[model samples]
Target: MIRWAASLGLILAITLAAPGAHGQSPAGAYETLRLIDGVRVLMNPADHASFASSNVVIIEQADGLVVVDSGFSRADGDQIVSYIRSFTAKPVKALIYTHWHNDHHQGASQIQAAWPQVRIIATEAARRGIDGPARLEGVGYETNPAWEALLAGQLRDVAARYQEAAANPENDAWRRHRFGQAAQQSLDGIPALVGTRLTAPTELFTADLVIDDPLRPVHIRHLGRANTDGDLIVWLPNQRVVATGDIVVSPIPFGFGSYPGDWIETLGRIKALGFHVLIPGHGLPQSDSAYIDRLIAAIADIRTRVGALAAEGLTLEQVRERVDYAEQTAIFGPSPARQANFQSLWLSPMTENAYKEATGVPIVQGQGELP
Candidate 1:
């Protein structure tokens, strides 16, 4: 299922999923679904009605437990904490951010409260994002006006879409009601900002590191620039497991904010990771390596098509019309919302970056940098 997109900004808020009274869904509540693989994988399906997804990973390490990316809102934070506690009382020793997206990091605050001493972990780039504006925003005005316009237009549309969904009673009354409360909490969080300390990672490192604990012998590899600048994929060599953050999703990869060529390279690296179980950021955990191979091929196909268009000097629109990756599109499911994915993949900085890489043109301003 194609999960709904929330704002990527690092705004503070705590929203709970409303539990329907007497078995009926409340104004804006969705059931919470859990997908666990006996200790390796844990998935908390946010807004069970809509495709709102977040992840909670418990890596049984040699010394302690390492928790990875939290879901959106406080409710998600609470749900994940509860889930982890059920498995082991081993205090969460470390927390890792796959990237800086709000859905992945917003719940970190709650985790800190539960495991006060837990050392939060993220790449320097990801940490910078948590504390600073996305690099694109930092250089937005100083860069080309065309690039600024593109980014603003995309963000505006995203914000507008959130508003529309939040206001509607049908699209996802559960998410609307739950996130509405979150929005209010975001408002409430302003005061706490003065003295409020959020649990942030103290250790920031770049490069692949293998945490050789017998409990969680996983290899954390920084498969350079796929989804975002700090994109990292976690591999459990022992369990043959891989956690692919936003790099690979169920139906289609979220290309809206991606670098196609880099993402493709990332996929290639993932294929080379040689793991048996591949857990994507969204959707049910896929254990098949063939699925990973298919994803890689699909991305290569996209790059081939888009590169061909750029070579012909064809516009993005013209390219979209001629290039049809129907199989990949079906993975996202059916809905008007899917159109946003199309726009994201085609128009987002990621696609633009991919175009530049293929054509050897310097990335323009407002365009995200691939580090």
Candidate 2:
């Protein structure tokens, strides 16, 4: 059974420090926010960048420590380990994966190397999904020189945009400039993946599993499919906090291989948990349910709008044109660039997924060539 805490103040007291403070590189600097007693959130600096990183939750237990999610690459894992050691000398006893996303669990190998005895835990579905083919086709572009060159060209174009944005001196321009810098930093970390090893989960659960610790009873639950089929949310009941893997990403939600219908229901369940703090898979730690509410509303809106368009005999392309995400774009960001990014990242895929779900179209997995 899941337990709920009573009225814990959800204060957002984040302490952003440079990685150099801990002898790490500036590019690897992460924001460490103490959510509550014995619970901290380590958020990657390049969060807004593409394939940037995931937010890692650290729970200091009685015996050692429990890590909610590993990060994007081996270097990210090393940075996480160093950050943990800065304050506590306790060994990481268990590494709990929120989902099977490469950005979330790929760093498990580094954690394992640091502590060989650490038990890696994930849902049974996630365990299988990890070893499966890449979620989106043509995603592994690191191995292809042509793809790499294409990405490099795109990066250069973005750099040019950043330079233009930097001269504007507006808040939006500043935000764009920062995002460009972060994206460059994230790109720089790609070389670390050359020899990085991705470790699989040593322990798997079907429904729910508790990390039977007297001091901190960590409850891991699979609340239907949201981000992926194996999505898991780590509930720290005592601390009134929940680590909502990719289920509740901020700025904009990711819909690749997502179940839009089930995702809304899952968000409801998360809200029912009454968590004071939400540690999302990406972005910063949220103190209120506003962001989650927005995510739920967005998914619900897509299902309704897209379903209506499909029912009206409109094709996928037609539906995409008809369904204007004006509201979502306004809330997430109103800029043309932000709107385009959001549409490409979430809206486009979501529309197609929602249409498939509405029209009873089968989802074709592993159809395209691997990049």
Candidate 3:
């Protein structure tokens, strides 16, 4: 599912991306990183700045190419296709969606259109969730899949808001600077969203599946639920790299509708995989477990703190006030501005999610408002 994170407007940032292959493209173009011999990860340019796309991985196999996560919009899909064409002449044989979030899977139609015979793969739950209640509530998915036009029409209003914020003297220099950049990033992505259609997975599996190849075999398995009910991890065993959807994000993690305790176990499962390089859903590729460890610790801390406060009959707001994640938040960044992001983006929902898990409250799936 895509998030209108910029609407928060309090904290917007750009992640440090790996240098793009060949050379740097213009702004709004995703930066590229060649992880190994055959795999290249396209880092989202609008990350943390606006409603962004997830990192896209293109894996070259013996006969054809296999892709992980399509992108956020049709424009993203078109750009990915051009990149694929430039990288190799081989057709894309399969495209894998790690979850039901549109940011991760919304651009599938363009890729499938490029290669008509391409088999789009996802967990059976993700396939159902794509059109089912579990899918992220976005403009360009399920029945109301006109997100391109919908968002484009609303961009002017959003830009006006940014302009107003930039003019406000009360806002700090950082906010004004970030607002200008965020507005441009959102505007630049408008062309890509046009003509994009909602696409669902063509193939589904209940658990582990392997796309066998002599040079670049891909092993996919569904670890326990973390970000969503149906989460898949693509393990490139030979390369010792794993593409963990939103289950693992960098700098800040998403806590919407997440299974707190189960997410911890799921991260543990990923850690056991022993990947030399970790490709997160967003942000740059990681080679160490340091970020993962911090994520695990933060989730556990919030869940435990929330559960304990709830057991004592403390209300959600009161618990939030009482809980202190400053030490943990500082791990991602020490500045107050960065801490605000870690709090809103990660801590806030995570606390509620943990409380819900402990108190047996039903958390609604795919219910956030969209542009």
Summing lDDT over every window of 10 consecutive residues in candidate 1, give the lowest-scoring window.
Answer: 10-19
List TM-score per model, in order.
0.68, 0.79, 0.87
Question: In candidate 1, how many Å is residue 98 off?
Answer: 1.0
> RMSD, each candidate, Å?
8.2, 8.4, 3.8
Better of 1 and 3 by lDDT: 3
Error of model 3, residue 19, in angstroms = 13
Q: State in Å the error of residue 356, model 3.
A: 0.4
Clashing pairs in 3: 1-101, 1-102, 75-192
By summed lDDT, the worst window of 10 consecutive residues in model 2 runs over 4-13
Question: What does candidate 3's lDDT look like per residue over 137-179, in tens digits?
Answer: 4543443545555656555556666567667887688767666
Q: Candidate 2 overall Cα lDDT vs. reference?
A: 0.68
- lDDT ranking from best to worst? 3, 2, 1
Name the regions of candidate 2 deviating beyond 4 angstroms.
1-25, 46-50, 134-183, 335-337, 364-371
Model 3 RMSD vs true structure: 3.8
Q: What are the lDDT figures for the candidates, one per model?
A: 0.56, 0.68, 0.74
Model 1: per-residue Cα lDDT over 192-301, one tens digit each = 22211224566777977666675457677788877666788888876777888777765434554456667777888888877777777655567666766766766676
